[model samples]
Target: MKKIYILILSLILLSSCKEKLTEEQIIVNQNKKTIDSLTYIRHNLHPEYLKSDNSELVANEIIKNCFSVLEIDRKNLEAVKDLAHFNFEIKNYKEAVHYYTILIDLKDDLNNRYVTFYYFQRGLAKFHLQDFNGAIQDLQQYKNENTDKRTIGYSKACYYLGTCYKNINDQSNACDNFRTYAENVATDEAWNLVAGYCN
Candidate 1:
């Protein structure tokens, strides 16, 4: 009788201890909040794709933050990628290539999609440096590794391949790639290249 009573008491205690579920609660504020420095920097990085006005002091501050983050965590991939992009945005192609090379070399838990883009970015940097052979290699590798064929990136890659070939005076390959770009994106520039290069 005593054991039965104790077992019943334990069952009641366990049931009482069970957690109760509650509905999610959300709070909304109508006031406009002040923009922080990082937010401002990120916003500015877009629009023009960071193609201009990036040599200013405010832009340098973001680069400094990326470096500061890396100082604490050397293998921080986001910081490394940000550094690469910031340098590129500022037209510091040499530094962009350096950091992008590091990004390519560093191992991470992320899917390879971002890594593939690093190759494309590095290729563009090499192109800016007029290293046509190196740019061709990187851009080709990116094209091969990428699984999605219909994105804007693929179109840009095709366009760049044609430009690279044109730069090197490889007329046949330039015609082939420009036609490919024209068929997919149908941009005025691509059509012009096809007309000018491909008979």
Candidate 2:
């Protein structure tokens, strides 16, 4: 009888000392809150694409998204230049000109060589738009800055300048520029065309 009484007392003590359930429940609840916060952040900050049927609308939407997120101050000038290239691919010539101008301005900040690539592209656009005088000016700039005489671009610039001058009825200047192109980067086909036509 004494051993049975002791055993019952021990069982009563053990049961009374059991931990409260609140602490365990709180940890699980806290973890759930953390997950919910993460989910909210993920949904809020993630980029969403526009649903559009038109190709041009879709392209404009993408460009808008790109402009919003682009960090111009983050030393990503090259990225800005590449965005101009993308704009050109989409046939947004005016927008391409804008971006290329911005990129050209950034060159001073980067302290790099002043590239005439933007001028060349912008000149091409102006040429297509029949802004022959503007095209001629930009092509001249391209030519003046060109240090290498052997480059394909140099030859092209010379030929374009000749064409522009010819359009303006300055035959002497046109002949001179075309002759320079022929002498310098003269591959047979391009040179022959320039020589035969400009002469």
Candidate 3:
């Protein structure tokens, strides 16, 4: 249905711009529309949205669209990121890790300040997958690059690091990270973690 819609739209556009635009330009315009549609769906979907009966259908469409976008350009950053985040949101941690790896490989094409959180996000995904050592490496890099210790990003990283460490029986590191989280977040839950384990 979407393919037909796009084809019709492309034909209309191509006909209207026949003298002014080339075939490749028309195709690019069509691709942009597809990507915009995908972005809209991705942004509008809440975590709870998955409870709907159509949720799996919508998710499958998005996954298919993401792969279609990637087929056009493997290094297409937005497509790769959307796919990575989509998988992560659905709790498909392994696929999230795979796509995040591709995103990380594109770091040279990204702004340093903007892309730093990719590490933190991928670390969390790895943590969910129980890849504790990989999560530690990514989260540690995120911590090093993200100098603002007061932000939620740092606090969350500390929290996850503590859990990952605890999972691996590294009590000392776990306590230290929990203490850091408690200091920065100051949430009751964070303090409880510190008290329950660090103290």
Note the Cα lDDT for every prediction shown: 0.76, 0.66, 0.83
lDDT, candidate 2, at 197: 70
2 against 3, candidate with superior TM-score: 3
* For model 3, the run of ten residues with the poorest summed lDDT: 41-50
* Candidate 3 residue lDDT tens string, 28-140: 98888777766776777534357767765666667888887776667667778877877887788899898888777788998877668889989999998889999999998
> Relative to the unseen true structure, what is the C-alpha lDDT of residue 21 in candidate 3, on a scale of 0 to 100?
68
Superposed model 1: Cα runs more than 4 Å off: 1-55
Give me the runs in candidate 3 sitting further than 4 Å from their true place.
1-56
Per-residue alpha-carbon lDDT of candidate 1 for residues 1-199, written as tens digits (9 for 90 to 100): 9999999999987766652211111111111111233345466654444455544454567787667555546776766777798788778899999999998886376568888999999999999999988988988888899888777887788788889999999989878878878988977877887987777
Task: Write down the RMSD of all candidates, one decimal each.
Answer: 10.5, 14.8, 9.9
Candidate 1's displacement at residue 150, Å, is: 1.9
Encode model 2's per-residue lDDT on 1-199: one tens digit a residue.
9999999999887766554456667766765554444344234322221233454554454455445335322344544654576577567777777787787677667533355777777666666666779888878877777778778888878888888888888888888888888888657866776667765
Whole-structure CA lDDT of model 3: 0.83
lDDT value, residue 153 of candidate 2: 84
CA shift at 45, candidate 2, in angstroms? 22
Clashing pairs in 1: none
- Residue 110, candidate 3: how far off, in angstroms? 0.3
